[model samples]
Target: MTTTDAAAAQSTAEEREALRQMAAEFTRREIAPHLQEWEDAGALPRELHVKAGRAGLLGVSFPEAVGGSGGDLLDTVALQEGMFSQGASSGLMSALFTNGIACPHIAAHGSSELVDRWVRPTLAGELIGSLGITEPGGGSDVGNIATTAVRDGEEWVINGSKTFITSGTRADFVTTAVRTGGPGAGGVSLIVVPTDTPGFSVDRKLAKMGWHSSDTAELSYVDVRVPVGNLVGDENAGFWYIAEQFVVERMALAIHGYGIAERSLELTVDYCRQRSTFGEPLIKRQVVRHKLVEMRRQVEAAKAYTHAVAAQYVAAGGPNEAVIAAACMAKETACNTATYVTDQAVQLHGGTGYMHGTEVERHYRDARLLPIGGGATEVLTDLAAKLLGYTR
Candidate 1:
């Protein structure tokens, strides 16, 4: 279908519900069963991406001409929420949605050749791609990245290392941020580095406290040569692109944060109702009941604020700095709330929640990454302050 036609279809409530139901079924069938095994293995099977692609869940927000469903931000948000609500793990979502981070650069700025070669195949799930921006020394500081891409005759020699890369080990291509000019954000640019290219190596898959199935990695580029044509956008213009994209990245992290909290709350409620303490159901205790009530309140509040910010973003048809600030605030709110909810869920579960395989246990570990990932809570708060012109 044409982009306009698909978008028109998604504008209706019926179409949106159909898409959400499809995503829900796909998550239950493909993701729910294997989550524990995948979590233990520290990486999901790549086939899940192919399955999700076939179900039309992978391309909901892209243009139809590029093999997408041509839906807007809300449709994508619904798909994300539905998958999580249907028991898809946060690790699976991060690995599966790595394309959301990788494809945008090519779609927005790459040459037609790059788009045809990488973006289309990735959206089709024929290949996996990831974004590499956070470096070993420059966590959440894009401007100070130390990776250098020096131009040669027809190629750029790349030499740098990236750490904390989501889906890094299994990625077929990496949209890498590199320093092409001088120090700082103004000198940075993005380049597509194919895994097969010489001097590009997966240094080591880093073990983490959570999101085990997502395959975080440390990547090393030692004199890797990439065609100059692989440059995304103008040379030395990558900082602006990366900065602009942070809003969506932060929003995605926010969704994961709150979605996991909501799921944890649901499970906790069921557990509380069934398990008794002091000769009554645990939930009958005033303290336990109040804790559950607080958890529900936080999740609902976070969801509402996130939805409002996302709606404003979609209606504007582009990134508004204010909306971006709002998204950051929502992310911080959700992450903190999720932390509280998950911790309380664990407390409510007592020993059961402490078990390794319990859903709440997984959530408690996974929730730790929310404030640290996308951007640290401190960094985001500082950014928010700066955006509001709040200076000491």
Candidate 2:
């Protein structure tokens, strides 16, 4: 969904530059030094969140009214761009900035109490929040939630399960999609259930081929209950709430796709300049030079297209066909770039890229998930097609 900040857009180039530098420096000092260790540990420490919150990095794109640093989506784009440029991985971004997904709904449409209880602290990095939408049996089907939330006299009793939840193992609460009315799309509603609530449990810490540093969890909500006042907006509006949020997710993942692709290209470029192939630097060969040019071309196109979509989406002030279609297209474009460029990065690095500890190697594995995460490219493509009237 488009999160509108009442605070003026921090749209100035200079502000973005400053934000970029801050993000870059933060990554260099806090993240770069220990990324490998965290990846090995399969999760980031909570202390990192506290540090980032203290630094105001956690709230860059959120409004000051809600404890954010008071900027728009462009500021977020700039921040992530800088981090990725400084070798931050997609997994790290997901784990650290889960608030990007978790808090926007509260910040936008939730009650004052909800904002105070969850959004503010989350943006401030004191508390971690997660979005629980993908159930064990279905993803990309917001209308088909199996989770049920029955309203008691003063509480919402929730029962169902969520999987592939980012930061689920560490979250203070999950802004969950639950069924409250009849069956299907019209029945769904969003309710914030604190992780410590009765019957709420992290069933398992999932192991993944990528995003290892970001803890993914299988969560069970067996009679989890929260205050009835925890409902976000009206009951049975969860489908629209979740659907809009998914668009923003697509936009975020687009940034992730191109951001990592650009970083991988830079790393590969430096390696090519130093590594000798057949007794000559790889950059000296025509084929290698051509490959580098193609990689740069893809990265540039993806970045440009994604940025344009973000701008248009922001300018639209709310959802529009152009905005939605562009968001979908941008994600597909950037995801394609990430996969292609990361593969080439590994190919160019030859044996070195295949090594476990190599930066490009990690990116190679991480890039494989961009198309699959957020929304699968195939699914988004069809949505975009329908929006663009490309479907019968």
Candidate 3:
């Protein structure tokens, strides 16, 4: 690399480091204190969004022109890592940063009016936004959405119900995927539906085995009428828009998987060093020492591979075929690491790890969802095979 390139790389490193520190500090002060309370309540307080917005951590990865702190995916990854280091849980992240998934499509493709009305204010924490793609009947076949948005003059009349919607109960609006044309991927279109509009209702908050702090909703839309201007980019381009984000979304889940594993390792290591068994510290035992080594190896390998995939994605400006394959693999690898490491963490913690409200126990439960969300591990593995031409 040339001197100029080297200098730029150094600058990027320094900036990411500073961002990591800021995020970690914010988590220590803001999130760590009352996480359990929110977990118990089964939802986070709206004030948390306001607080994150004020800290500038909430919008760290969005563009400054749209009221964000102006960074990219790598920066957000750093922010995530820092927060995880400071004991941020997966549920906390899903609840606190729902905007990460919600506003990207709007910011990238919405009209200027829509950007101002939704993206800007949402990033500023004055409003909450959510993406509604999953439905009550369909799984990952996003193209087969049962939701219908038929055009009538100047408005699209929408009728459908969405399930497993993250941050759904708290969202001011939903960026909904609806069928506007035929019966395939090409027919899907995105429309922004305000929550309080007539015929829109949050059916209920769904309970989960984990991610308790992150509210999930079952939403119903009965002949909801939204203006034609609420369309994201074009009449039938929602599939492309959503597909475009899959790489980064998968990478984010990869980070979440291994990020919690790293934290679980830390907690387990401390616990082993402190806890006694057979009149000696657990860390002194041969088997316990080996377990710690194996845990570190998995965490390190997953983090390294995921970060590499993220860098490749950033350098390419998007996901090419190779990036997509690597991202899928990275997610699967990290998720596997998370499942193994978190399970080991709990086992190493003994009875304390199984207890509700214990940190390792929380991680153990939260890790279960990573492989399922963002796309199931089985789904991603098959996708990677197809992209890599292994199916032939």
Highest TM-score scorer: 3
Q: Candidates' TM-scores?
A: 0.96, 0.96, 0.99
lDDT of 1 by residue, 1-392 (tens): 89998877667657777777888888788878888999999997878888777778878888786668887777877888888788776777889989989988788788889999998888888899999999988999999999999999999999999999999999999999999998888999999999999999999999999888889999999999999999998999999988877888888888888899999999999999999877999988999999999999999999998889888988888677688778889999989888999999999999999999898999889889999988899999988888877875
Sorted on lDDT, best first, the list reads 3, 2, 1
Could you tell me which 10 consecutive residues in candidate 3 have the lowest summed lDDT? 57-66
Pairs clashing within candidate 1: none
lDDT of model number 1:
0.89
Q: Give per-residue lDDT, candidate 2, residue 162.
A: 94
| lDDT by residue (tens digit), candidate 2, 1-392 | 23443233433777899989999999999999999999999999999999999988889878788898888777889999999999999999999999989988888879999999999888777899999999988887778889999988999999999999999999999999899999899999999999989899999999998988999999999988789999999989888887777777889899999999999999999999999978999999999999999999999999999888888877887568888888999999999999999999999999989998789999988989999998888988999999999887
The TM-score of predicted model 2 comes to 0.96
Per-residue CA lDDT of candidate 3, range 238-322, in tens?
9999988888788989999999999999999999999998899999999999999999999999999999998999899887999
Ordered list by TM-score, greatest first: 3, 2, 1
TM-score of 1: 0.96
Instruction: Give the clashing residue pairs of candidate 3, or none.
Output: none
Off by over 4 Å in 2: 1-11
**Model 3: lDDT to the true structure:** 0.92
State the TM-score for model 3. Answer: 0.99
- Distance from true location, Cα of 390 in model 1, Å: 1.4
Evaluated against the true structure, the overall lDDT of model 2 is 0.90
Model-by-model lDDT, in order?
0.89, 0.90, 0.92
Clashing pairs in 2: 1-244, 1-245
